[model samples]
Target: MDKIEEQLRLQVYLARCGVGSRRKCEEYISEGRVSVNGKSVLTPGTKVSDGDEVCYNGRPVHPEKEHVYIALHKPSGFICSNQDRDGRPLAIDLLSDATHRRLFNVGRLDYMTSGLLFFTNDGDFSKLMTHPSSHVEKEYVVTTKKEIPGELMEQFKKGISVQGEFFRLKNYTFKGTRTVHIVLEEGKNKELRKVFLSRNITLKSIHRIRVGNIKLTGLASGRFRKLTPREVEQLKNQALENKKNNRGKPKR
Candidate 1:
């Protein structure tokens, strides 16, 4: 049987209870607005287990379970974050007419790049996809400023190390003058751009085509859909398999 762990910091528990995110939860705790088992706790790192009593903002907290998973065809200029302080276009706004569930993106794609994005109330799933250890495959079609050299394409396939970030191009093929189909697993910020930039290629446009086994084929930009049950199951199984695969490997 697989061992399940429900361990997290106290502030994280509070944040999951809808009080706020971990950072915001710290503020509430420090201001004496949070309590556990009737007594206020100011520490953020206090370990919490399942069934622990927590109260925030004068209300008894309950674990949120009405999870929602949504896949959106993100358009350029839409930030992949829940809230942007700069008032820029955001992906969350794309789901404004959605069920009103407090959903967060499973992973992120930069504002300049557009394509498939996942959002969910399932924090576990979100963490799995967003976590570097998961190594879920993400595919993007990128346009470059100039023609890419055959040698650089070879380097892309062999993999390139950026600063300290190691990334391998799972698949790469020229689409046209300066466009290439690239598949990657590392979803770090602007990693794609940095990769091509290292090869002396300047990125002009980028659009994601898939995440893991889920694709944005029929889905048009700015549209959203609920992931089918099979897709969800496939993602979960893939995550578990990936976790098992990376048990003792060096951090990549």
Candidate 2:
């Protein structure tokens, strides 16, 4: 029996080669900035094989030398973006030596929030971890200005409607009158803030402590370490299981 040929869409191939995210690569394809086998390919769906030569903006795009998965203890002042127009510090800047490798944040942490932020060269892994349908849980320890009322706590546990949408905490524990440890599977932007705002609660601090099973333990703020193979596999499995469970559900 002959082995089947392996091929991937142009954009996906570019992402795998660390050129950019799949969406950015699609834009490059649409703009006629990508070429395969010396011919420009304007279609994002164009397929390419391992033997095909691929280039972007007249530069060769080689496959990533090795996939790097990193967990960073993001500080409060840095933005989780590839580039910042205002010259503010970016999360990627912390990985100085790996900048050339096209690492992307697995998800985002707001500039004011600090905690476990993941970086990876593998675009697929990033997508799996960040995609809404994946339903990966995020755990946070939040500090507020005042204690949460019993009524509001019950409302939070049940679910609350905000901006025509409903949001709920998967689980929460009150560490004290002003501190709460919360877990959320559907990580909408500023989700906790929205929940608190509805109840007239003032948020003082929000720090993510865990994603999936990975935790922000020994790593100091602004520091990072590569993830072990087992850790990476565990995350991938979680994403896969969540995706399977969420089949046919509307994606946010």
Candidate 3:
């Protein structure tokens, strides 16, 4: 059999088909409403190759358009994802004034973790930003309950083994007595919280400041703006380079 040259995750392809957003696509899969080549897929990670038969609710699916990317200065209360069951505020609220294209946040920032959140309709771009291999740098400014010690700072920079998991901040520094800025290349759930807990430090708050080469930059919380052309280009180039680098490495 030939490879799926532009094959995407089945859930991702379902989302692209407008069955719903990506997250919802997973739920449909779990509910057994999605089928590839006539077989139901309950697993979320299955891949859907080009020309594959896809059906949802007994109907064929069509491809959705590439999305437009925007950076939102998400406020402390808004959820990072689309359509929360809790009915809490969502980042989409910030996009009311936006009329050009529908968008979705690339990655997530916890409702409590306010700051830069990327919104885009481009499924491929969103996929790139979230891929672990992208190695995209995400920077955050956080407040700690205890003062950061010098030794801990050095150790954080050097990396540590916690619960058999190796971790480190790509960069870390004390912003004040109980505050600091840290950068990481991965986005494990509750990762920052775990990083602090492992060091016996309590995380008071987390505010993301940057993603890839784009910074929040003067955008007030609860507000959003379309990405500039140059900013978009840089992100695409960065993702491309990361992909190329990964392709050259040996698989684990």
Order of the predicted models by lDDT, top scorer first? 2, 3, 1
Ranking by TM-score: 2, 1, 3
lDDT of 1: 0.78
Worst 10 residues of 1 by lDDT: 1-10
- RMSDs, each prediction? 4.6, 3.8, 4.4
The TM-score obtained by model 2 is 0.83
Question: What is the lDDT of every predicted structure here?
Answer: 0.78, 0.85, 0.78
lDDT by residue for model 1 over 1-252, one digit each (tens)?
111167778776765654444555677788888777788888778877766677776678766756677899999988976568999999889898887666667667888999999877665666677666777888899888899776776776786789988767777778887888888876667878888788778888899999999999999989999998889989989977998998899864
Candidate 2: C-alpha lDDT: 0.85
Q: Which of 1 and 2 is the better model by TM-score? A: 2
Model 3 segments more than 4 A misplaced: 1-9, 18-27, 33-61, 99-102, 246-252
Off by over 4 Å in 2: 1-7, 20-58, 98-100, 245-252
Candidate 2 lDDT, 1-252, residue by residue in tens:
112168788888887777667776798899999998899999889988767888889988866868989999999989988778999999889999755576878778998999999988787787788777888999999999988776776787798888877888888888998998999887878888888988789999999999999999999998999999999999999889989988998743
Residues 154-178 of candidate 3 have per-residue lDDT tens digits of: 7767876677776777887677988
TM-score, candidate 1, is 0.80
Clashing pairs in 3: 67-121, 67-122
